[model samples]
Target: MGIKSFLASRKNQNKITTHMPLKVSDYMSTKLITFKTDDKIETVIDSLIKYRISGGPVVNSKHELIGIISEGDCIKQLSDSRYHNLPMTNNTVEACMIKNVETIDGNMNIFDAANKFLESKRRRFPIVENGKLVGQISQKDILKAALALKGHDWK
Candidate 1:
């Protein structure tokens, strides 16, 4: 068969699938274990262990994203408390979480989100809408999305 005819024969035997470009919201985890500013450090630690999560977002009663608390931050708190001879249990999430939180746009492309994670060296980025905590996207989420698109002709 000629080149054009040969290519048409193969194309007729296989199906092509197209997908809308992936977005962060499509893969982000909406059900999150969030912490409050006034919550005790002990409680945060227990939750992190129970949920098998390294960190959680700190929000106000109004659910506004405020800060983020991580295992590293918790460990740092323990070290600081020991060095200062201060009691750690009495500390609050507000005392240890990372303030000036950076959130990601839910509509951002999944690949772009992956780049953002690499650039910022952040494991996860929270999504906010109308000043409320909506969801969170993680490195693992992006990896999963990439795997899901393995056979698709998309970037």
Candidate 2:
């Protein structure tokens, strides 16, 4: 290959791997809104609605994440209540939360984490470090980070 072409090709390869090292901490939302496992589902719903969020992490008394509760999960209870005349107000978050959750390490690069998001049905992922919930990253966060890269390689 010509010297100029080889150098241009190498630069393009560097561009791909350069952003691969960008950490999730750089884009994750550290000011996370969360819920407690024992918190009443009604309260959970209220907080979610108030914050205009679809869901949040469910933590325990020691502030350790246990699960995630979302509006989609609540819909089942609401539907049961309407069909069977059962009360939904008495439920706890633990009863409706998704106990099996996928979490990401806070230090994971944005590119890798974005791939995880793309492969899963989840809209958001909890960022954990040392088994403690540190922050949250959503699809929007990845999009925002990607958009920030647009002007970087511009002429």
Number of the top TM-score candidate = 1
Model 1 root mean square deviation, Cα atoms: 4.3
| Off by more than 4 A, model 2 | 1-21
lDDT of 2 by residue, 1-155 (tens): 64568878888888653453268888999888888877887888798889999999988776688999999888877887789886776588888999998898878888898899889978999987777888999999989888886656535
lDDT of 1 at 83: 97
- What lDDT score is found at residue 118 in candidate 1? 91
On residues 7-42, what C-alpha lDDT tens digit does candidate 1 reach at each position?
Answer: 778888796766755999999999999998888888
Which ranges in model 1 have alpha carbons more than 4 Å from their true place? 1-17
What is the lDDT for 92 in model 2?
84
Q: After superposition, how far is residue 64 of candidate 2 from its true place, in Å?
A: 1.0
* Candidate 1 CA-lDDT value: 0.91
Worst 10 residues of 2 by lDDT: 13-22
